[model samples]
Target: MKKLYLLLVAVLAIGTATMAQSKKALQTAVIKTPTVQCDMCKKRIEAFLDKEDGVASAVVDYKRKTTKVSFYTDRTNIENIKTAIANVGYDADDVTANEETYNRLPKCCKKPEDGGGMKKQ
Candidate 1:
């Protein structure tokens, strides 16, 4: 019947649309940086990621000196996110901190090699 044919076509179209809309989800990398002695690092890192375009959420574990991020696959990617964090003076997995940004960290937040010697950055 024509009605059955139309319904089948509509269903196929919808299936295609749904598949196109479902962007691939990636289990992106985690970054571990020195969180130093307080909540400042956590606040700064989380706030930074919150404003980034692709980031869904960021969780900073101060005790472990690690940050776990969940992000969209389409709008942005891991490298861009890592660069954003590095721009703020924190080290992301693959991105190193710029000297200028690194030096700008608070005394307590400074990495061990920088002389503040609190811990790794």
Candidate 2:
């Protein structure tokens, strides 16, 4: 009887604490990624964002040149997310690619003007 009583108290306390904490706002944004050239670009950007804080998911559609990102507003914002993409050597909407990081990317990942693109079969 005593154990049962204690368990009930603990559960109530935990519930109250959980209820008192407000839910974080989640937002989704689609950022244009015109410079993404192929599957490699998609994989690189998606993998990089997957480890970023507040980012829940990043879906890159290379063919369409867009990235849909779902993230927690309290933890991070759109600008930060764009910068993260730039850090991985790709352009994220108005956020241009980081020059140094862009230079380090493989030939296949560089912009077409820089001679990077899928070879014609």
Name the top TM-score candidate: 2
lDDT per residue for candidate 2 within 3-119, as digits (tens), equals 999999999999987765534467899999988988999999999999999999999998899999999888999999999999999999999999999999989888889999878
lDDT tens readout by residue for model 1, 39-70? 77778788989999879888888678788898
Off by over 4 Å in 1: 1-23, 26-28, 35-37, 117-121
Instruction: Estimate every model's Cα lDDT from 0 to 1.
Output: 0.77, 0.92
Clashing pairs in 1: none
Model 1, residue 63: C-alpha shift (Å): 1.7
Show where candidate 2 strays beyond 4 Å.
Answer: 1-24
- What's the TM for model 2? 0.82
